[model samples]
Target: SATLRIELSRPSSSEFTFDERVNRSHCSVSVTNMSQQSLAALVIAYSILKRRRKSEQKRSCWVKPWIMQQSEFSACSMLAKELRIEDPLQFRNFVRMSSQQLQLMVELLGPIIGKKDTKFRTAISVHDRVMVTLRFLASGDSYNSLQYLFRIPTCTIGSKGTIVQKYEVFPDTREEWQRHAEAFNVQWNFPHCLGALDGKHIVIQAPANGGSHYFNYKGTHSIVLLGVANANYQFTYIDVRCNGRVSDGGVFQNCSLYDLLENGSASLPDHEPLPGRNMPVPHFFVADDAFAIRSYILKPYPFRDQPAPNRIFNYKLSRARRIVENAFGIMANKFRVLRKPINLSADITANIVLAVCALHNFLLSTRDSRENYLTPGVADSEHPETHEIIPGNWREDSTSGNSFFSLERGKRDNYTTSQRDVREEFKEYFMTPSGEVAWQYRHIV
Candidate 1:
């Protein structure tokens, strides 16, 4: 074996190799019998490698030339501008909002998302930021795809959750609740109803170290989006990003809305008599069997073999509850971002869901866009002449598949006397002339 010696030394520029100085190994082999020619070749090789590393560290350009031409070539600059002038329908299809609506959004969110320019470069405009965000919401395209289409950096575009305020769509006072109640009574024949309550699973990527917290009965990772919608299919209140493992009843019980209602700070209207009836009933939301039988929550009577009165009650309750379902369906069908598994982090996914919910309400707010946004037969409709249920276009597409799924019904628990009494009152009212509809019997059969 050749004898080896280790020598520790501080680096001298021409003496030690780059690895030894950077790695701080501080030791070099000194083979006394090695040829001088071999040592000279090794030093030359190290010098070449060091030179190559420095060249590789240099950036090719500050910004790509194509990115610099975004003002002229970007989708927002070209397609959006052209559509804003020539075709409004096509513009809504592209950005998921009318041009006027887009501008309004910029005005509303400008202060929050706007950035100030630095000496090095100009900040992205608030209008451009909103446009990019809307495109992300409409298409659910990856950030890389958005970067090239919008000519914005991938890091700059994403859905922000800062806009999910309930006061924008939800009722805040007894007067507001009364208005919603009137709408439900007129539209769905459900008296003293505030809105429809429901929940759907929003699939998301498994989070790091999440274990089974985000896992659901469907064998996928998800979060729940529980919402309350008025009769017109607009969301009034939404509790987003509840753990998928929890039942809808559990999620509702633990949410802030429930806390407020329990504390009597939710501004719920006092119990009032049903239309044309002497008995007063609590104002409540209609949901499916997945929820509890609370005084404020009216779920349909379980089991299909119910008596005639019970079946009629279920039919009417389902008709009212359909608003929330159709709200989810129309959203998933239009936005399409909700149709597939979201690959973002849990926090970002929550923000995206909330953003779309806000966008849904915003789309409904505009008189010009509202009619076209929810056109005739786009959502489930009742035949004017025959009263038959005509499935919406969304229902046809939903059959293909989507991330939207219902929660499993929770185990039956003994309901309080008051809860049981509320359901019975509604059941009895459906048989009365005031609550009964000419077509309800035909539809129930």
Candidate 2:
């Protein structure tokens, strides 16, 4: 039998019913040969019915009631809490500027940090959050206390957390910190200085074993050392190896900075060569009598008689040296760890120190004006003067040596007793500037 193929035409309404009945047999045989118009009409009808069913299902599954209920829930409510913004514009402005500064640091350290994970992909930029966290730490509030202020997680506040690790991109090297200081210097005003130097202790939970070494004379355990700060009080150098038993002088001597100074390799910023001199030896740091005297390291002059000019020079130097002391004070007050005893691993303690110093610099650099974070009952005006004997010049007696100070003997005993004698001698020398102020001497005693 042959497969028959036929065509059928159907018209609208009553005409289609009559045609279908009349051609029922033919229509059954020719269904496969229907016209393109008939096929198109069938597809259109199916699509319309599908859309209607989908619309009805969507209407039945509406979530407006649940959404409204959620909105009414106290936890889901959005409340705009009023906050005191010192300068809403200031932080944004600083972010724009600081981002450029941070980029420069990345460029200079490109070879080292470029290959490592940058880790800056959070909603808050890593650098901005780090800077903010540091400011909070330096300002000296408890970690739990800063939740409302910074809107950061409590876990992110300390050195061991995600926030700090993400931001600690640079290596803990003197050169690296120096580069950071250079960047900070560009943004802040600190003349004749690369960075400020101070020491701080980071408190920790007591170690389970061999923890006695961390204990210090203050009846607490700590790691004592020196930190280099920019004029804005940011750390450019941090040495945290010295045991808490060591003095600042001991820490400096053990640090690579002392070796750099001794070998004449350390470079000072903006230092000009002496007139008619081939290479300018960098100017040394300003320290109390704790450090050795080199042409580079400047210390206050020991008290001497008859010269008001020298005394004036010493006074100015002492005033300048106070920047470091004030820097240390600020560090201690801002991070209660320094005020309290530290009890952590030496490495962690060191990291805490660096982190705190970095934060101090950040706060000092960002703040409109720098002020000491003084303790209660401690007046800003009451900072005591630190007296240092000019090393290599303290003489036991005028007749015994051409110079008054004995550097050789002082070095042996760690300069402990000798420091006392030098202070006394300076007091005596100052009392008799052309004439005796006997009553003033009484006041000093």
Candidate 3:
């Protein structure tokens, strides 16, 4: 073998050695022989190649806009499109600000905005984004789904954390909601009407803690209550915190509206008729039979002999009242979240419901114009005009009575039936053949 020399270098006090040898070029290299020098060269080359590959991988981490996949950009674009709101600040410039209306609302909701120092904060934290987030929640889109539509960061918009705290700080009380009713009436061509009241089921997830409390006879977990919508289909009142077990009538009885009417706490401003009605006006609202009929709460007349006129009035009222139903339908349809089972806490769920109603009103108000479903047209003489009214003379049996009737008796004193009689009459009216009623009114104009 050729003469061989090995030099061991250990900088620290250790038995392990790193060998070094003098190469043909007189350069010091770690090796055992010529073959070892060849191996060392290959190891250095491999190390350099590995380092370059890692650098390339790091560069590839950031995708270029052009080379970026469509799926990635689509997610962001779709969200931006949905959340895009017409410049409200720009809208403020052209639309005259109604100071009186704002003042009225402020007064009604004032108590809820109790003395909280944090209300005046200038920073735009997640708390400050409540209104926008409420709009998203009301719309019922996933957080990622809404990310591109609204300017709000996706991170802040959907989190349950403090999302509703702002609303608690700026609650819209019953009175404040009612103030919008007049504006809605004027816009929708309804006269002397505050709002249309009706009930709906807000389905919720069966609570882990309160399963029996939310269970309803309908075989689902739901909170049943009423909502009052103005002529333009804006919510003036949303009474949703009731237990799922309560009846519509029971819920209405305990509602703030009932309290206001019963206690005379609700002040009716002297009805000044618009230029058309020469006399002082009266304020009134449309309600279904679930509520007690009052001067303010107009109900359909019970069935009577030749109940045509009462039927006509009921038909008109129904035509007007359909707005609330349509409003609820649109809300549930657009914000698919409302259609699905809500799994949030009761308080947050209530706020979410109200916020959705408010957003519905806002969108309706801001649209180019609302389509009027009820065009002024006369009923065909050949086609007998059908009217469903509360019936008279069926007052003796109140309980277990027919639900349908003609309310021909205009006077309030005439509405008398024992609770039993009322129920019996309701059953009879409910069982009455629609064909028979149509045949009876077939000739009446």
Candidate 4:
């Protein structure tokens, strides 16, 4: 029972073996018993076997010379070129600027965006930094979404904390307002029109402990961007990153743009006579029913009764005011980011809003080659081009401002005597020969 027996009737010898045969329960082996050449052969064979196995099956890894060598900028350029994205429109749709414009942009903003020196540490190229920032702003796409396309840690580049800086983007100046007024007068025939004012709710995640603070009447969490856009759909005055719950009127009342207007620092053009009349009309910001009617900010009369004059007022105001809608529509269409909710903090949201607005102004300044594709007509609730203010029969009152002061005055609860007078003046002005449109009577319901 003490003897251990193993039965192998016919044993076979295998290659590359260091063999030992057990003789008893307590067995001992001596190195002197084995031949030196045999031991050397075993060692060599074992080593060869290990190397062969390693050669046959090795650990998988991903690495390539080209991938390792190319930087982010080089890679992006190579990709854009390889895809044949040469056309301006194609480039605009992809990265929101033409190739030339992109180069000029890199020249302008490069040094300021941390591309100053790479002698001390490895730094990202200016082109790479700007392209990433632009792509983020134009598409409203997230850093995670762009990784596969750009092969970069996009969230880390050109941003302090997921925010493109506001100082980099330029807003409309006093001269810009003059230019905007000229454009509105020339194109839409609405003289002294500074820009169309509107607000859009940029949806966002429920802020930390932000219960209803961000909840809007639209039944969504958002930050409102109140933009005053010129006829070319460029933002002249931007009141960005307001609470989503605030009304258009509320935003206007509280914004710095409005403050400038109130404090007389906006340097707006003085009240000027209408094109066909001597009564000077003050430059005003066009808005919808969401805003209160003011001497400087004109809104359409309440859409209740069917007076010929009131209908004309609605039609005319709608004609000019719808530009805001068109501007917002074009912006949302171009930057699909506006169409989706942005998931970021308030500070970051404000910075992003500023950047997008600036990009809008840049594109407008550059002027897109394809006219109809990017320039949408004024948006109307009823139709794209709803009001036809060319000509019609409502020209009964020919004398300008005649009997305009004596019209029936029904006002909103908040309207003061002077505010009502301004609205009435505009209404009668439309009924007068100077303000009347030939199609006013024809379009009336």
| lDDT winner, 2 or 3 | 3
| Reference-based lDDT, each prediction | 0.80, 0.44, 0.47, 0.61
Best by lDDT: 1
Candidate closer to the true structure by lDDT (higher is better), 3 or 4: 4
lDDT of 4 by residue, 1-445 (tens): 1222222221233422222111111222224445666567556655665565445453344433333333744536666555435454566566766677678777767557754545533555677777777777666667776654555554454263332333222234666667778898776666678878777667777789988887776566777777777776666667765786665457667678777778887777877666555656678888765666666787776747868788877777777776776666655555555656677776777777777666656666644532523543323223226444332212222321111111112234366676666666677777877667565676777
In model 4, where is the ten-residue run with the lowest total lDDT?
Answer: 400-409
Ranking by lDDT: 1, 4, 3, 2
> Which ranges of candidate 2 are over 4 A from the true structure?
1-81, 84-206, 229-234, 269-282, 303-307, 333-337, 342-345, 366-445
Question: What pairs collide in candidate 4?
Answer: 391-438, 391-439, 392-438, 392-439
Which is the winner by TM-score between candidate 1 and candidate 3? Answer: 1
Each candidate's number of clashing pairs is: 0, 13, 50, 4
- The digit string of per-residue lDDT tens for model 3 on 273-341 reads 433323344456776665666656656666545355445445445555766765565556444457566
Decide which is better by lDDT, 1 or 3.
1
Full candidate order by TM-score, most accurate first: 1, 4, 3, 2
Candidate 2 local accuracy as lDDT?
Answer: 0.44
In Å, residue 9's CA in model 2 sits off its true spot by 79
Would you estimate the TM-scores of all the predictions?
0.85, 0.45, 0.49, 0.69
Candidate 4's C-alpha lDDT? 0.61
Cand. 3 TM to true fold: 0.49
Better of 3 and 4 by TM-score: 4
